[model samples]
Target: MNGSVFSSCLEASLQGQAILNDNGEFLFVNRAFCEHVGYTKEELLLLSIESFVIYEANEDLMKKEPIIKRGMQQKQVEKLILHGNGYLQTTLFTVTDVSDLNQGYYHVQLDKIVTTFDDVDFSMLESKLRDRDEVRLPKKILDGIKDTIITIRLDGQFLYANEAAEKLFNRSMEELLSNDFWTYLKQNNDEELLSKFYQLLAGEEYTQFEVYKKDQDEWFDVRAYRSDDQVTLYFINISNRKKMEKELKESEMNYRSLVEKSPETISVHNGKEIIYINPAGKKLFGIRSFSEGALNLSEIVVAQDQARMRENYRMLLTGKKEMTNSVYTLKRLDGKKFDAEATTTLITFKGKPAFRTILKDLSERKKVDDLIRKSDKLSVVAQLAAGVAHEIRNPLTTVKGFLQLFQKEQEVKPFYLSLVMEELERVEAIIYEYLTLAKPNVESVFSKIDIQVLLEQILTLTKAQSNMNNVTLEFEYEQVPAIYGLEKQLKQVFINLLRNAIEALTDKGTIHVRILKHPDNQVCIQVEDNGCGIPSERIDRLGEPFYSTKEKGTGLGLMVCYKIIEHHNGVLNIYSEAGKGTTLEVILPASN
Candidate 1:
């Protein structure tokens, strides 16, 4: 080959190589080298090698005088240079003598071995150089990261720790590096974590584990990635999330305990399918265990109520209505019926839509209510007896007087006449009671009655009794709707209530009667007395027949009053506090 051909081949091979004289000035560089460093051929020739040493590493390179002396004597040297964009690069050069005796001229040949001219493109070479520069970059970048990053050796010793790691562990990087990484763990004695760490050191690529930080005494989730011989651990504090989970578990447990302990039957269901049931529910349904599919809500609910239950479910699912509290009649497993009050709510169970219901058995309450009803009936019967007595006593008195006058002759047998009069008086009293019970002519005289006037008349009639007891009578009447009823029957009711109030008062006690219209447009007559009130236990029995507190009370008085009020389509409500007072309120619907 010709000399020109050889020169061209050599020059092409040195395209990315560069050389610099011992004076720190670039003497020659191939086209590829000039472009890789982001400089033109002329610019490379003018530039000094030290200019590309990177400002920070320049002093270190200057201190190494042996490297410069060796390169000058041997005519070959290898050194790292900083590119224009602050990157380090490795370069090899072959230098020639350029002393003054040689007429200020020099010749040199250079090459790049690690990054060859053909293999190293300008962009790729720059990128590789940048990566090398980054290896020596300061750790300030890690300070801005939120997550804690730590590097540990195979011996469980911390090699490096970032600012976040320092804050989280409450230790300085120097302190962390000096201590064993396990020593900073709150539960350093935990065998499980140690085992996991052992597994991690045994070449396990990625592993997740929980460790407690001693500084905060809180748990953290650590995800580790192992590369080469070092392990990189990323830590995230999840204490708050764990605490919330614990609280939710406790709340659920408390709710379950309440359901299990309650006397009322309770069950949770999704529509007609039962998802969960309490012990009470099982007992109420006569089920041995809820595990049996037969004990589901669909099976327990009566056929008649099924449709209604489905409708309610539809309403709840569609968001048109919410689960409501309601009273419903349920059929028991034995085919008997019972009343229940159910409170329902929408809930998510096991990540699926569901409804929970709490049921309360109302059987005992119903029984008590029935007893009250019976007592009311007896009260009415007693009122009728009193009314009969009032109507028949007058005729009985006339008969007795006439018989006494007839017996005045003394000619007839005195014993027989006396016996006949006695029997006649007894028969007349019985007839009087019968008349009262019949309530004859009471309802027949229906008329619009002013409650205010009626109350006043009753008060007038009881004035003598009030005076005997030294009780003061007071009246508070408001303009109210008139009530249609038998005036005489109503009068009797008012009299009975007023008399009871007056009798209860001690000396100087007050009796107050109030007349007003209720919210339902009904007349309300309230007679209150400041006297010794009945005990709570005895109040329920007040309207029953033959139940009385007074020694002379026949128990028929209040009963008679209750009957008359009922006949007039009214209700009597009584309120009393022991040693305080008693109040009676009579409510009658307004006349059309």
Candidate 2:
């Protein structure tokens, strides 16, 4: 046969036709073949047989070169033809060796294409096939499919089922074809499935959903559509995809659990507003939901710090800074301002850049700090009680004895009266120093303080305590400039420092207090003790509340000292080592 004549004959056939070489390369393809796969004739010629043919058997067509060379003729096989628009069309495939017509070329036929069969014009199909001598292929085409296909009447009676449907239903063809689909569904107590079937009969174009078969341990993506007066259902196994989705959901749930149960206030803010807040955040902010519109930064942060907070958020969201740690005064829903430390980092939330801030409330910590200061001052006054009483008694007795001398003499002696007045002034000075330390309120008034004279006064007050502890307190200083600060608070700070040094001594030890002025005008007040030294680990935590090196120490004294020095814009540094002595250096800015 001539090649052009054979091609003309193949093109006249109603069914789609293509001819391939032994290598599965398309040698010739008819217009119908191109229409079936929604590709042009020229485009199909450029492609190979394996390019468009997907086997229902999941076999690799490219690896079937040996079989094709052996003159294999596969009949009534099911395949999914690739369409130009990237969708699959189920069709019956047939390939036969046609070496007689053209050496090394094989003829392929595609028929029974399962499209929207409801809209198919049977009259036009018959007219197209009138000239063909052969009839449609048997049920082998449908049976070769992997997906379960079944057809039912509008009354729910089973009309037809493929071989795959038998395995799906776990029944033979005789049993399945003898019963009604709805009756079987009802007996199985599958109300959802039965409802979908009825809904298809009620004129729905199609119904689709996923169904799990526990007995088979499989998941199926099902689609049912009206086909003429009956309905056809297609069930495709999607267990692998479904399992992956299940795992992703579980991972998301685990993440949510961790976030929801966290004790720290965690929240996510998109540059403009807060999008999410954990349970701890809701409680901290005294709000019910983040969706409440009032979660804007301007509303939540105090007016004074709003600009700073907004800038911090902007920096985090825009990736200007990877993370930020800063303190802000935040306002609660109840209209109260509380200080919080916000540690923020950039994160992807709901697929967009956002800020995750963890807020730590400092209100309670501040209160504890204030109470420690007051308590430390009161403790100092209590410890000074014995010393103050003894000092006052000696002066009172001298004044009493002088008054008696005045009473015994008829004329008053000026020298003896002056001695009595001097004793009374001595008593008054002792009382004044005692009352100064015992004052409860922190003085906020800033003044030019002579650091040397302040240290002298503190050493004078702690002198009795140091003597009783068998510790010697010594003070030395350069002619440093005065520091601008609250005098009373500074007195309490040095007093606490001196007392701690005195108490640290187990046996006789010397505490050297020295004030040095740096060229930059920074004052350094050094307190060194030759007592049992602090361990390395505890040195860093010296000023923390309730943390102390001494066994009976409350640690409030050092804590109060640190707080006061910090208020004076100074840094308190502790240098210590075990079995050696400890040195506390307080650096403060001097008056300009």
Candidates' C-alpha lDDT? 0.68, 0.74
Q: Per-residue lDDT of 203-304 in model 2, one digit per residue for the tens?
A: 897999888787799999999988567677899999999989999999999999999999889888875688888899899888875573347887787654
lDDT of 1 by residue, 1-592 (tens): 8956754664576456444455546655667667656667876676565445433323453455322332144366665555543345666655555445433333445455344244446455433432333232224344456778887767667755677987887778668767877765534466656777777877798999887755477778989888766687888878887789889999989987887898877776777577778888878777676562345565566554554455456557878457666566787678777778878778898898888888888888889988997979888677766755655565567567667867786555676566667757755645654457556345385788777887878888889989988999999988988878888777767887888887888899998888876654567788899899989888878867557877645565677777777666566667798999999888777786
Q: Would you give me the overall lDDT of model 1?
A: 0.68
Best of the candidates, TM-score: 2
Candidate 2 regions off by >4 Å? Answer: 1-147, 152-164, 173-180, 212-219, 237-263, 288-294, 303-323, 373-592
Separate clash counts for every candidate: 7, 0
For model 1, name the residue pairs that clash.
383-559, 383-560, 384-436, 384-437, 387-436, 388-435, 388-436
Q: Whole-model lDDT for model 2 versus the true structure? A: 0.74
Model 2 alpha-carbon miss at residue 126, Å: 15
